[model samples]
Target: MTFQYIAQRFERSGSGSDSFKALFKSAFDLMKEDTANASLYFLIAVAAKSYVRTYEDQAVTEEVAERAKTILCGYNTRVLEALAAEPAARYAIGSGIAYDYEWQVADF
Candidate 1:
């Protein structure tokens, strides 16, 4: 999926960028290995790393960063598998209603 799609879904869920960067990195790793958009993912990875470097609250060690990346990559792989297995429902359900009751509550 494109970064925009992933970003939209992530934002819609009201998640923070700190958490998102990790998942995005994991997704990029997967994409680079299995998809044709490796270059795009690489660019995204660079941007993500830059964002972290600019905004990180405290100093992060290389070891910790690499370990976090590895863990999140595993998580991303499992999520992708589950998504592929159970695709999202495509239909939209809507409801419409017309009020027929009196406005008696206005007498309060």
Candidate 2:
């Protein structure tokens, strides 16, 4: 499925960036709710590609990748759900990656 492919490519299993954490913060701020780290879903999406820069001309600096939070939410809502539903996916909900996730999006 599209979700599986996208997840594999973007999960960055062994790789964690300060940018990823920034995306988490931004998405949380944009969504304005903390029930779940759903924000991380959007964060991963925007961080995947430089082409998504600023995502609306908002600003795409590594320091402010949160701006793309607005753009990623619409597309990655389901991806978040899939990861969250996984027992091993606690990190997707803001727990931090405890294991590698397969992100096979190379076809993109």
Candidate 3:
């Protein structure tokens, strides 16, 4: 699934519900299981960070948000820097290419 599609699924699954952690966990697990999709999964986790921020008034706690941010920081600095350099690249899900069209991760 594309990042957009997966993000939409996260929204449809209920943003502030208890399922957020589960969904985020699932995405993280997918990252661990599929190395080729690491970038995509990382983006999903980044989206989760944004999600947590967007819905901070809901069930998502500060601890969970902090954990998400911490995990994102665990990624290779060079890779993150490379991705940061090409914010407008096209990322195809399952293609093993780390690119996302106009996806701004600056806040990340």
Candidate 4:
């Protein structure tokens, strides 16, 4: 799956980037080496890092930043595995090119 896909999913989940970054940090030391698990974690790591940039929070440690990238790359093969699983269910139509779809369907 693309960054957009995971971003869309979590973004639509109404999760904060701070939450995502913290979750990834907490989960970082414990992710399984198994391909699927690793891949999802990698997605989470990358998403956490990328999403953090959009926030107004104070800068994170270079250590944290490096750790995020390292964890994601350690599972590179797994990340690629996830990337092969599916595409974005929907595409965005405007700026940022970020995934912004609503996860729930509602009668309007």
Candidate 5:
């Protein structure tokens, strides 16, 4: 499925923080289990944390959050950097809010 579909699904049906976390978990699982949208999944993983950090009372545990960070820091720095460099590509990989939030993360 496209990132747009995922975003729409989340907004329409993912009513709470737990639902957001579940979406993140699904993205993480897809990242491990498939290769088609690794960049997209990475974007979702990071955006999930950002969303929780701001609006949600339910935060992703530090361990899971750190693991996601470590994966990016250790293994996918180039992936994130490359995606960040292109505005359109980043948008294509994420929905509006996700694109904005996750693109900010790619700079670091």
Candidate 6:
């Protein structure tokens, strides 16, 4: 699923009550589907991190943040493994120069 679709799902999943938990559950459920696209996990990680950051001004218990971090780390490791198994390729821009591209896992 696309990031926008994930965002819509998050909105419908009642994120306000327990934002981090809801995000974690959503990501966990999606991961259980066993989608082969690594980008979906990356998007989920981005969405979860972005949602969690929105609570910076509020009182986010350390335990909640740590729990979410742990789950996210596991998902990231899977993404890295998926990327490693894919072949390296090149992409051509509008200028016609083909540049080599590789997927790099970003730490949250």
Best by lDDT: 5
Model 3, residue pairs in steric clash: 91-99
1-108: candidate 5 lDDT, tens digit per residue: 544445455555534456557667766776776565576676666666555655466445656545444433322333344345575665554454344454545422
At residue 87, candidate 1 shows an lDDT of 30
User: Across residues 1-108, which tens digit of lDDT does each residue of candidate 3 receive?
Assistant: 333344445445543434455455656776777666566566555555555556656565656555544433333223334434544432422122223212433332
Please identify model 5 stretches exceeding 4 Å from their true place: 1-9, 58-99, 102-108
RMSD of each: 16.0, 11.7, 10.2, 13.2, 10.3, 11.1
Q: Model 2, residue 19: what's the lDDT?
A: 39
How well does candidate 5 score on lDDT at residue 54?
A: 52
Per-residue error (Å), model 4, residue 86: 15
lDDT of 5 at 88: 68
Q: Model 4 residue 8 lDDT?
A: 39
Best by TM-score: 5
lDDT of 1 by residue, 5-107 (tens): 5544543442234754664575576576656444334433544454466446766565555544443343333333433442331101000000100121111
lDDT value for candidate 3?
Answer: 0.46
- Residues 1-108 of candidate 2 have per-residue lDDT tens digits of 234444444343322334344444444454444434444544453444433332434434543443333233333544456455865454444333212122422211
TM-score against native, each model: 0.37, 0.26, 0.41, 0.32, 0.45, 0.37
**Native-vs-model 6 lDDT?**
0.45
lDDT for each residue of candidate 4 in 1-108, tens digit (9 for 90 to 100): 434344334434334445556545533533453443443554456445554664427565555545544433333334444445553411111111122112211110
Give the Cα lDDT of each candidate.
Answer: 0.41, 0.40, 0.46, 0.41, 0.52, 0.45
Assess the local accuracy of residue 103 in candidate 1 as a C-alpha lDDT between 0 and 100: 24
Better candidate number, 2 or 4, judged by TM-score: 4
User: Which residue pairs show backbone clashes in model 5?
Assistant: none
